[model samples]
Target: MKFDCLIVDDEMELAETTCEYFNLFDVHTAFVTSAEACREFLREHEVSLLLLDINLGGTSGFQLCKELRLTTSIPILFISARSSEDDVLIALDIGGDDYIHKPYTLRVLLAKVKAVLKRWSNEPIPEEDGGLLQAGPVQIDTKLRRATLNGEPLKLKTMEYKLLHYLVQHKNRVIPKEELFSGVWGDIFAGDGTLNVHIRHLREKIEVSPKEPQLICTVWGIGYAFEGE
Candidate 1:
């Protein structure tokens, strides 16, 4: 069976409530109380998005996210009470699509989830010339939402792919932080820590050495520029 959304939370009451609320609005949602249950559920069903909590009793949601990344690119939104910037950064860095602080209103969360699904269903932005985008050793198939390095496939999550696609599309120009945030994430409120971590992950995938990246260069006081050979 295919589910539109799955809420993986140790807070059973909150998870159940969220699931019921989403289903009430025709969202087709489900809930699981632990990371193990989440894994088991995925094995048996198809899920479009995940509402994950940071702490899952004995199992860490971050670990589960990392593990899932090895196989699937399902969008994950972290919903937790941990409001620390460090926690948010870690969540985004480790493949989370978005992070929502706890004590959230059900309506707002449902709207956000619907918005994400809608965005996922939309067609990828195409190049002016049209066709595959090749720069340096990286090649992006916009239609497929996939990127390859040196002809090898890269396992990029949704946000990572969006960031890379935007950067590569506008290569050789220094893009300001605010512009990249708004352009790629569609939100100017996205934190620098979140952007920085995503950039590091991108560097690790495309650069010969993440310590000395040659493609995506930083402008120190400003932002980043993609200088492809």
Candidate 2:
């Protein structure tokens, strides 16, 4: 299977150049000039990662990152001319996995992309795959990527599935946010809120009550764990 990436930058020259670089590395990247183009491309195709710029046509890439995070859990790498510390924090805070300032080395950019993709690759859900990984009444299929509680399937998104899978695989252990981010989301460098959102969503689905999460438990400033009998 070909790993695909979408580059959303209004800088047509730089976008094409980067596209060429990715092609050289067999990353199979495609370029879009605007956020609308990105929306359209993603609707029809599966993307492994996103190379986004903060200034795209008149819209901020950070805004688009949050919007994308609402639906998909694709890895987001921010490449922009804005090198301010505040800008970097804001980008990572809003679901961006990597922050790259402009005038960057093409080799460095390529390396970062490769590193992120190697770390986090979401597998496709398979059929005839229900083998319940049960802890209490909550069950998750290790292969099929589905979770059930009280015999009802939980419609988990990509990120939620990953979080649940990792926690369940390491059941009874407290997983640090850094480890979770690296293992599940791919460690290009993502935001805390990204993990929080997915964790909140998973609790809502797997736990009987999101307010009092039973399945996905938090460990204060540490991270989260999946505990069951």
Candidate 3:
């Protein structure tokens, strides 16, 4: 069977409640209690997105995310009670699409999930000016939501694509962190760690050397600039 979303968390009560609430509003949601069950469920069903918790019956969600990323590109949103910047950074670094702090309101979670699903299921934005945007050896096809480095396809997640596209659109300018957050996430209150991690991931994909990135350069006390060709 196919589901729009799958909730994988050991907090059985919360997971079940969330699943029920989502289904009440036609989200077509399901819940599982452990990583083992999640794996088995995936084997038997098709899920468009995942709401995964960090701790799952002695198995880390980080490890599961790493394993799943090898086989899937579905969006993974980590839901946990841990709210430290390091936790958020680690979640994004480990292939998570977004990190939502626990003790969450159901309404907010539903809004976020719906927004992600809407984005996930849509085709790429059509370029208003048309054609590919080139930066050094990299190419971004806005119409296809595809990016390539040295003529080879780059596997970028949703946030990565949005960040890169925004940076390229404002190339040669040092965009403020606040501006980037507002522009990409539609939330000016987004944490710096979130932006920093996405920038690091973008560097890994588009730069010849992520350690010393020439394409996306840090502006010291300011923000980032895309020095494109």
Candidate 4:
């Protein structure tokens, strides 16, 4: 079975409530109360996105996310009461696409989920020209929505691909953080930490020395510029 979203939360009441809310909005949703249950559910079902809680009984969502990333590129949004910056950073660092704090309004959560679903959908973005964008050693096939570094395929998450494509499209120009948030994430509310983590991830993939990135250069307080010859 295919589900639009799955809530993997040990808080059964909250998970079921959120699931009901999503289903009310026509987002076919399901819930599992433990990390083991989530794993089992995934084995038998296809889920487009995950609303995962950090504290999942015996196993942490962070561990599950790390395990999932090893095989799947599906979007994972962390939903937790832990609001510390470190928690958020760790979530994004380990393959969680976005973090949502607890006590979140249902309407807002729904909007965020829909936006992610839209971005991660199979529908390709409208291509420019022949849709092949090159930046130094990196080449992006926009139509196929994949990128390669030195002719080798890059294992980029959905947001990483979008961010890289946006940077390459405007190569040599220093794009401000605000512009990146609006253009790539399509969310003005996206934090700087999220952008920073993704930028670092991209640099690690395309730059020979991530510490001193040549392809994606940081402009300090400004933004980033993709300088491709």
Candidate 5:
């Protein structure tokens, strides 16, 4: 009924092999070969996370991810051979949590998956001074694990929330990319592309004009800083 991970890939052999490897590591994984099968499987079982391939039979993983995001916020990691920056950006724009290129090492993939699972399963990081954190027009309720911009709720993904929380926690001070990786993601393996895309997403949600952001500013060659009123 409940699975730790599900691989939705048209490449049956690869999916099966990955599934086997995850299971061997006690991850409770499963595999589905098409968008339809993936939908059916989700209807019947609970999956903690998804490993989705961009190319699926008849329907692309992009389509499925967009559809799924309408209802679920579960972590979706896109696995594809398409290594172009465009594809990676598209995947993140369409609600994917992370992108993993093809020819991945099984152990590395497992470690990433385990890290995500741990983040979702555990409680939010406790704040020494627990309460609301305001940065300009945005308000972060650390206790409720929710954020609001201009009095309206901001629909943030798991990592987005973590990123914003960390930024607001140290408002007006530059936070290096390395510090963000360690503080928010709890792993330094995440690339700048991943962090940049998430920051763009956050800007799109909270800024009146995302093109000219006021709350979150980039300190070129350094990192980002959250400027509050």
Candidate 6:
């Protein structure tokens, strides 16, 4: 079955063009003009991925992304005119999988969509928090979407689980925030503060004191690393 996708954008021409391109490539694509419409589509249909515009008829993609995270963990790719570094970081922080600038090649976009769909919807849905991914007192169960500190269950948002999962999967090394954003959320625009918020949340859940985190440690101004002793 073809993976379903939704594009939320105010630019009708661009949205239609993208939808047409995806359809041509056999990725079931639907286009909408606002977050509200996207919301409706999500409820009535099954969408494997989302192409969200940061500015949709003056609506904030960041806010929409935050809302989407609360419901489904489906992949979200952002398309916007904003090219600022901070904007990109905020996109990632809010749970968007990737960011795309205007004037992008439709071919590249299609390739990215296929890759994301394949990864997030990998064959054989992993069991809830499937298997234990452990590091010191911290544990990540991908299938269950849960993390643990010592023996206690650590409350983790969908994005937090993904961020930590990516960090643990590449443990013992200091990874750049951009790379983490791209890899964990998908290679897209991630806002600067997004990772910080999730990291703080993760630390609060795992670290005895977030001020002195022992597991997910910072690599100065670079990014983060999962330290296992």
Assess each prediction's global lDDT (C-alpha) against the native: 0.87, 0.79, 0.88, 0.90, 0.90, 0.79
Per-candidate TM equals 0.74, 0.65, 0.80, 0.85, 0.90, 0.72
> 40-124 in candidate 1: lDDT tens per residue?
9999999999999999998899999999989888778999999998898889877887888999999888887887776676676
In order of TM-score, best first, we have: 5, 4, 3, 1, 6, 2
lDDT (Cα, 0-100) at 191 in candidate 4: 69
Q: Write the per-residue lDDT of candidate 2 for residues 105-157, one digit (tens) a residue.
A: 88878877886777665455333325556777777876666777778888865
Model 4: per-residue lDDT, tens digit, 1-229? 9999999999999999999999999999999999999999999999999999999888999999999999898989999999999999999999888888998999899988887787677466669859899979889998889899889999987788999999998999999999998788776656687898999888888889999888899999999999996
Selected candidate, larger lDDT, 3 vs 4: 4
Give all candidate RMSDs, comma-separated: 3.6, 5.3, 3.2, 2.5, 2.0, 4.3
- Model 2 lDDT-worst window of ten: 121-130
Candidate 6, residue 182: CA error in Å?
8.9
What TM-score does candidate 2 reach? 0.65
**Candidate 3 lDDT by residue in tens digits, 1-229:** 9999999999999999999999999999999999999999999999999999999989999999999999998989999999888889888888887888889999988988887777677665559557588777778888788888889999988788888888887888999998887678655445677788999888987788999999999999889999977
Task: Please provide, for model 6 over 104-186, each residue's C-alpha lDDT reduced to its tens digit, 9 standing for 90 to 100.
Answer: 89988888788777667654324433476777777777666677777788767666777877777677889998898677756
Which of 2 and 4 is ahead in lDDT?
Answer: 4
The number of the candidate with the highest TM-score is 5
Clashes counted in candidate 1 amount to 0
Angstrom error at residue 21, model 1:
3.3
> How does model 6 fare in lDDT?
0.79
TM-score-wise, the better of 1 and 6 is 1
After best superposition, candidate 3 residue 59: deviation in angstroms?
1.4
The residue pairs that clash in candidate 4, if any, are none
